[model samples]
Target chain A: MSTQASPETVAPRDGGDGGVPEPSPTAGRSGPRQRRSGGWFVLPFAVCFGLFMLWPVVHGIAMSFTDESLTLAGTSFVGFDNYVEAFGDAAVWNALGNTLFFTLITTVPLVLIALGMALLVHTGLAGQWLWRLAFFAPYLLPVAVVTLIWQWVYQPDLGLANQLLNALGFGPVGWLSDEAVAMWAIALLTVWWTVGFNFLLYLAALQSLPDTLYEAAALDGAGAWRRLWSITLPQLRRTTVLVGMLQVLASLKVFDQIYILTKGGPNDSTRPILEYIYDVGFTGYRLGYASAISYLFFALIIVVSIAQLRFFPRQEG
Target chain B: MTGAHPRRHDRFTVDRRRFLRLSLTASGAALAPGLLTGCGAPAPGGDGVGLKIWDLFSGGDGLLMDEMMDTVRGGPDGFTLDRTILEWGPSYYTKLAMAAAGGRAPDVAVLHLSRMPGYAPGGLLDPFDLELLAEFGITREDFPPALWERAQWEGRLYAVPLDTHPFIVFYDLDVAERAGVLDGAGRLIQPGSPGAMLETSAALAEAHGGAGLLFGHVTDPAQNWRIFNALYAQTGAAFDLPESGPAIDTDAAVRVVSFLQELFDGRTNPNHLDYFGALASFTESRGAMIAVGEWELPTLRSTGIRLGAAPFVNVFGEPAVATDSHSYVLPRQERPDPARRREAHRYVAAMLRQSLTWAGAGHLPAYQPVLAEPGYAELDPQSSYTEAGDLAVLDPPAWFAGSGSLFQDRMSQAIQPALLGRASAEAAVDRMVRECADLLDQPNPVR
Candidate 1:
């Protein structure tokens, strides 16, 4: 996947040449004096990335070791104290617990269902463009828009969710009202709003699948389901693996969904880890603590992503 | 559904600090160049003397201040006003703290009096001199003493009382007339008991197409707890012991909690959240009454909703309503500046002097002179609750206390379940006391 996608795309054409020096190993071939000049190109970005992004990451790591806040004159470096405190805070654990549960509930079904949509649309079916448009339209909507729609739909009185329930002579689900049903309700909204993107990715991958494999499978008296299970699934494995990992990471940082619906809950039941980090940072004025939590989260995400990369040789195959 | 989506449109918000830091870094990046080329000015003086004022009073209050400042700046040349306008609520306080911590605070700012203690213990405020205040003609005798008490920290003045905005019970007078709740002056009469309130609420409910009496949900448990606090104050129930143990467990408090629980009709929640939601439906005459901050009156009036203001219900048969005062304060500056300080003082004085004009919008004036202004009593809603400032009830001063921070969040969290009928009132109050104990016990060693 990496090899196919790289495209050897250089940085933005002209590449920071607003009076900035050109950076290339070509300078080394030119001469020793010219080779030293390329350092200026690397210098500016290195300073910016180090200062803005990398420095904060390091500072956050350092802060995670301290039990200090911004109010104090000097942060007392109480080693591993914040982490211990964070673990004890039930709210933090609840957020993490909710985030993991939401991720598992949403990502698996979303990817598989999106895969089914991709397969159906990929087949020579009627109203091809209509199905594609219908499936892909919602993905273009913003998170706030999608959430707003769901918020109205999930409203208990005079809402479409309850209205639909009543119409079916079923019990009115407390979609975002009750603690028990809220996360799953948000997951359902997630499936509707974002399944399109995964579907598009899967469709693109399936389009690129070699026709010969399916034709060969068909020649052996393979029906639609058999062909899909053997040829189609194997062919789309790389895209599926990539999308699954990406979706898991995406779902873990679910802020806007939970924020709009339930707002971390009836009893902090719907709170996600990212929302907790945000609450700690901006809302509570604990930037030091929020940054520390964010970095810890970053490490966790990196570890999970690395584990995904471990599965890549087979994905490539 | 159309209007329900919060219209989120973003303009670029580059903060002054970040932008300054960016400019500084750019300038610093040019420092080597500046030293080499010698084109830059010297770095700004840390010891510079000038008046710095900060406040979160925007919209009409902001415009009035702007016009007032332009008049001041253009007036008899005595001093300069270095001003900063910060967005209000949580951001305002956070910025205030960060500025004080980084030692870049303004010399004058508006601090909600409820917030004084939190900043005070940290030495984030410079105590104002009574003698200095007397020269400015601000005497303790002139202002309401209860509000005046909110501005002091440790027997010293940290802030001057500017104005107080209390929750006034607003009713549709047209609906009230139908309910036969008329005073001798033909105004809406104030109810004085839990039963009288329910009776009046039932009357208002019947008059307004039988919609429930309250315009908002019990999810506003701070207001509910405040109702309890007022009742407890009347019945003499303390959440703390005569000196020990949590006393929210007291009998009077339990009765108050039960009484509040009874106010819910079992019909429905407001089907909305927050002030915006309540204010919207109230304007449409969906409900007959709402208890809300005075700041919302002008907005409601602008919606063409006729309103009558009364003191909140006297639950234990004594008048009590929660109030929070907004005062013009000086955020601490790192350096000393005499003249700039005087100008900041003059601006606060002038704003207070023009409090009648401020109240023309919505707020109740804290100044005695402003209250005595001719035709001050003629303003409809402002006149109605004008005396509410004279007898104010504020949240207890603590580091954890403010409008929507930990205290409100915890109080709201505990009581909202009971409002939903998910938890009993006893269970809700129990949860509140238990949680608040931990927060109260979370000591600030700095304090």
Candidate 2:
């Protein structure tokens, strides 16, 4: 697959105005000759991908038009009925709203905090190794471990959060149970657990910037904040857009933490659309309905991803 | 009639034999991946039958089941059981359903009684033959009437019940005694009415430095439903089912929700404790009472806290308790071999006969012989609530109604806000009614 597709992948390169350096012009000559012999190499992966990933995507779409159930043997098509029901379903709307709200809540914090941590760590702080390790460690932990740790921390009665709050002369808060606070609690855990990935991204982007830019800014009679605004901020704009796009997509798919901590309640206050789809498909045995709702979510994600690409337009180097 | 085709049979017999051999080879080819991958172990081919069984039992229950398997291993019957333990709840059921649908389900699996309606109606389970079971020394008379009834669908038995775990009240015996809510024999003084139960909670809270009765309704709607169902059962209010939808007694629901809200007002009962948190609170002696199902028995017992069991408080008028049962079911297979089916039945019979061993985990055995065992009456908490078996009020027969089902989750969502004083009891009940109606209105594909 790589050999056959490599030519098409490289064909557009020749049309570009010298963006990529040509290490060897003769290297492309052998590509077509290897294509036929290499097909077998990709067979195994193609079979696996076809069976596991591609098949489910196709099967799920096919199922969305019917009244298929997990337990029932026979399925009959009822064109658009499941989709129609999803559109009218209040729970579906509630879950979608909650998911969007959660994305909005966490995306901003995740991006900003990650950038902040990256900047702080990049400034050559006294304990650079400790700061880097501390900022990136939580992401290395499994989601279940993160949720379990935070569950104890958020325990209403004797959790670490409440204990600390009480000692500070504040009242105990129902972090996992209160409808108003539950999603925020989940968002906070998510930020703490996941900001590491975004932080690492920003850190890499920060390190890759040439030191001469900062030196030139310093020579222009600028302060630290001015250097950051004029040079550092402008240089980091591409990474910021990339990080924001990734973070938004990740936040929209939140399920594990909420499932582990709240199971989408205190009254479905924290139930994101993925959980609602799980409930519909698996718990309710309405596979067709779940598929329809999922397809709707899939379409939304595609639209959002496309919209982001259009808005950002990949800054030209 | 036997010899009618004798003249033409020689060719037919040869053709039939050839067809059988061809199909067998084809099937072997189909099953090659399953044989190669360690997804599941192949049946041991020998004189003895190899039975594949799946269950979701873990922790104490898993240990007890393991002991029962050890006993089964030594039985006279030449049967070997290959056990697979899956994660409990929706995932377990989903895998079972998927395997059944694909015609590769295990010979036997454990199922919650409430899940039977969902599985049985969809051809996911096979009905048990009483006569076949009778040969193994098991009969209908061995189980309680309610459990036996629950195990059957359309007058055919689909599951052999292991035990019934009813919703019961567990109190910290030491705390209750200190609060003067215990009788002379160290048993909880039964609350004759809802008010009396609240008073007991109040007294216990005062004794425990203002910590009240703990129930895990904070986030789990299913737990909340168990408490609400038990309370509603006491009110003599039953759901009226019509083709259109379920007509629940709103008045009863409103009263029950309000009473629960009052209980969780944080004066006598803390309003914010989840399932595990509430159990920890009770064991830690911060709470005097916990209104939960019998499954939590082993957990409570392990706390080493002196605990006593009582019936769910009758807030309305009668002593009705919400309950669910665990039972053995044979998931339907595309081609079920008679040898394996017979072995599965024998295994179930053996498990049922050893219900006393199962009873140690705090489940009230559906097997009547276990109850009649001389030593069973000596079991502290089990004996204390054996009467709850007769009073068990099961979830209404709906595909959506069961442990870990969406019905319970939605109900909990509706009621939790009220329990936390975030929403009015009236609003909660209204939401519950609306959700129940929506669920009922949806077409049951299994039907």
Candidate 3:
């Protein structure tokens, strides 16, 4: 069965099941002759991969069981003490709750808003190229730049946001000071900065959609909205799922925006788990405990990814 | 002319896309090592001939340090000074720790006085000799006893006192004049007591038609901790750590916390402005007074607003003010050179003698000689608040207790709800006591 569902599926026709496509029946008979060359070609990547990526993972897991500190000269084995401390630590729980709250508040809007933007731009908007560029431009900016822009925008008294509200006859809102509104303000900034990536993905999916389905629905006396509901929505299902899953993972690991915008402030209302881990590892100098918390978070990410895969098993043709 | 080698040349022609890819890969490979270390300089311990100093000063502080360095460089010390400015806070400490660990730390460095205990025990700092310091006319008696004691660890002096920057009250002179709170000399009259201070704030609030006293009580845990420390110091309470528990004065803690909560209850003092916002409100005349550190003196002075600064009044019945000092420390050297050590002492002494220049940047000089300089007594705001030097209440000595340490951050976070009116003052005090107990329970890894 083919795992390729989208029109631009990654699978090649002859290799739909696995491996490179066999151009002819005897293609595999010559595979051994090319295997050694392939191994030589992969040697440099494997070396670098082991040195930078694989070593850190293994070392981090080992350090999680010891009492390692960034500045201290020595460490001793502490078993699972750090993990136990984390389980009972209120700060950890508060940060975890904040992270999950941020994820929920951001993921749904990020997915739906990107879909809406893609549809609007794809509906023969004037200056098509400009619309595409504008929709996706924010994704290219550095996270620092995005947070800096929003920081000024969210300033309570003399900010542009309050000024806008004043013109609309609304009372000034404490965008960064109010604990209730601070995280939501960050979520709004996240949506504005990152919706561009998902928008581009949806736009690609929409462009690749076969026009024949819409034409057939049109012939059956369907209205424009009906055509969108019947043809466009269903065709975009796989991209929607992909976008949602990507957004959930991205939102779960949020650190940069919160670090710059709030530093988990207004009483830790916006503090996420990663910031907690950072505080432990770098700021607090408890590298071992920090590693344990991070590994726990890493395990959580893996479980979530597996659950997503089970729920949205790849469709095949 | 090259017809004979035409086929060979054609075989080596590169496409734009492939050439671009190759260039990117090459540049990235060349940049990887520097990116990993976060610095591009050749390794730290170089020759140890001239003074290799490290500091974390920027903006106004940076300007003052630059001026001082220029003076020292032109002096007859005849030794070169190589200065390295690191990003402040943990990043600076982390790099300093790593460099000391690698036996490549600079010859001289500046450290927060509160951090000395932590660094001293970890062997990241070297002890200074009293005889060497006295050769340059800087003796133990020339410093404030409270600050002088903080520069020691394990019965040895690990840091030399530089300057103390304390948390103080900055008031708008125009507003104070309107409220009739200023004396004949245009200085704010010291409130006799906490009750009197609250009345003064209320009167100022009525005159300004808004909150009178502004503080960064919303998100700045540091400021909240400073205020608490100041008030707690006034209660004459001490932090006593037993083997596995905290011995705190709960009554004093409750009293200070309750008083702070009332002070920021939105009638006399608004509790929501951040550090910058509070400063902005004071400068813009939206508020009559603000409580912050003297580091903001430059920003306030540049505003050209009618301003007056005073050491935090005896609001809690004592004139104590919370403060931290920046001092020179010698990072531990794997191999000590006598000549360099002597040079470091001379450099520190010269800097101390010129404390008048440093005072211009809004720091209270810890060196007693500078305070007696003929010109020092005439400096406007610095002289006005000179009493804070004697009144400075240093942070509690612990591995975690310091200006930017986790102790302040954690305690402030726990107590902020009371400031914001979300939690009862009693409950906030209880929470803080419990958190302090937990922190005390942790083993001192550095020790």
Candidate 4:
């Protein structure tokens, strides 16, 4: 039963059930190990993981309950006050809108382009390494460097983009400078900077697909586009779901690029949720409120992740 | 070795909601709340009771500060030092606020003078005790009367005065003479009146080739707001009648906005950004005259560009300029001992005297005695515009108003539209007022 089917649904078999394993009274450590005397083995990692991740999450969760600040010594447990305030916060909705806007703009197109690049490079394309290298080289640059390079490119005056625009005698558009264009500008930057990773995943998936399906499709005269839509996509269903979820999660949490490039500016037009949390947590000095926003954000992300997980519903052999 | 089954003592700790809800179900401060985040490792040397200091100064100024700190460290002071340097802008304020709120705070720090008032009444800072401050050679007499006045809160000082770094108009003398905008003394023409400024700027623009309007530094709106504030002050307009709330809709602000708007007329530069290298080059016959802080004077001089410095053109009537003061502050320590506090005070004193040196970093020292010293009186741009302080100008006292740089946020929102001629002066002024109201409405409790 454990060998043939699902990885997700392994249930605990209780005593007396045919599947239940008999508990051995003395098989486990009744000695020093049983006493857990060597718990020190896990001590180092437990301390680190607890301190860094577990601690902040708990702290943030608690902070959401009060009128908390970095300035105040004592916090008043102003029940639901933080949530109530957030409900009224225009920035909350604005940031949500910006984040959602970014996700919509980048996610679909990223999957498509990444898949396209992968299919191109995977189907016995000439210069495959060069193409893969070209696609993958960008993903290796850290987020900050990617943002800096893209920022220079997107700069209104003296930027490559505007320089091209003016050279053509067209108007010099404020790519990142204009309020209406800022989000799109950032989304575009995000696509360029991140598509490489998704591309690589797609390429790997494409390579792993059996040649038999494509051979059959070719014999049946299924066009390249037809094969991609029918054979390639179905074969890549799992990879597609994984990549989509990863991009969605990563996109929702985007901070560094926006911070470096737009700084959520031109009237906070580019403000992202993470940036807002940073602002409220650090800048506004309203840690409690910031924590509320963060947890709300985390909850939102978790809900989305769960929905995606169930929506994809991985298939079993 | 003594580690238990490591059932993770930290995890499964009291949840915040459970705790807060418990307190709400029960009462306030009944239980001590340790709602802090990600306390990764205990700080290096966490147990030694070292004094921690945080600051956001970089470049030459940062180097100077480090040297000063080095001097303190090498001194016979008895305290061990732990320092953290944070990045500037919004990030800086956010971290500072978090550290302060989280209670694992630095023992000493620095804040802009204009920014301290906002922090005070909120009780983010433990106000400096006058008697304690006096023990450091800092008294009301040590700084200018007006600056000393700004440093106080409810008649008590919260931030000790450090230095005033105000904006100065940088002009290249060589380019000015070539553009025929220079005085007989080889200095760039000193425009005392608004009309003179426009005329000089126009001539320079024509001679240099142009964006024919005053270059508004849109990226740095805090400076822009100060520009408006100075003009408003010249017209006897205050930014806020705290009693009546922030009053940006006043006629004075409108007039200031209109005057600023008019600078975008074709006769002047309409570029929405200021480039120093461009302006310095222009002053050196590369571009044209530009308004910048006196800090750039050294760069201009080193460029071998002849330079001139002055208060921003007085738009409403009187000569007014945007000014801000930097100050050293002592944050509260958890377990304060007399000796460590005394050493911290010693560091403060040395810093204050060292401020004259800090002045060379383009600030006019707040310590007035430095002004009388030959070194200061002879200082270039500081000496030229030092008087801007007496009748001087500054941004409104708001937590949102200083180098953490949110000061630029809405003011740019308000003024950039007008300066770009997107909104008329009246509408822009109204918008600015509304934004101010909105900002005031933010119930951001200070840490």
The DockQ leader among the candidates is: 4
Model 2 DockQ, alpha carbons vs. true complex: 0.19
Model 3 per-residue lDDT tens digits across residues B20-124: 122112222322432433342324343534677889887687789888888878845545787778767655765666556545567788888877766888888
Say which docking band candidate 2 falls in: incorrect
By summed lDDT, which 10 consecutive residues of candidate 1 chain A come out lowest? A7-16
Write candidate 2's Cα lDDT for B356-392 as tens digits. Answer: 9888888899989888889899998889999888898
What stretches of model 3 exceed 4 Å from their correct place? A1-41, A129-134, A159-178, A314-317, B1-50, B241-243, B336-339
Comparing 1 with 3 on lDDT, the higher-scoring candidate is 3
**Per-residue lDDT for B313 in model 2?**
70
Off by over 4 Å in 4: A1-55, A221-223, A314-317, B1-53, B67-84, B98-107, B129-136, B180-195, B211-216, B219-221, B241-244, B265-267, B274-286, B297-302, B405-407
Candidate 3 chain A — worst ten consecutive residues by lDDT sum? A10-19
Q: Give lDDT tens digits, candidate 3, residues A1-317.
A: 11124325621221133343344455456577586787898999889766554555667778789888655558999899988988888888999899899999999999999999999988999997888888778999999899888877876655788889999999777787678988999999999899988887788788877888888888899999998888899877767866776688778878889877677876688999888787776566677787788777766765665566445544422
In candidate 1, what are the lDDT values of residues B1-447, reduced to their tens digit? 111111100000112122222211222232232132122211234234345677787766677667666666665653466666867655577667656654556667788887776677777777776776777777888788877877887798888877787767787888888888868775666666778767877777777774545534322435555555555565544445221334464466567766666675544224233344466567766777776767777677876667788766566754666777778776665563665566566667766766776786678878888777777978887887776775567766666666545566567667666665667778877877776775665434224
Q: What's each prediction's TM-score? A: 0.81, 0.90, 0.88, 0.82
Which is superior by TM-score, 2 or 4?
A: 2
Error of 4 at A190 (Å): 1.1
Q: Indicate the worst ten consecutive residues by lDDT in candidate 3 chain B.
A: B16-25
Candidate 2, after superposition: displacement of residue A136 in Å? Answer: 0.5
TM-score of 1: 0.81
Q: Retained native contacts per candidate, as fractions?
A: 0.05, 0.37, 0.11, 0.23
Name the lDDT value of residue B169 in candidate 1. Answer: 75
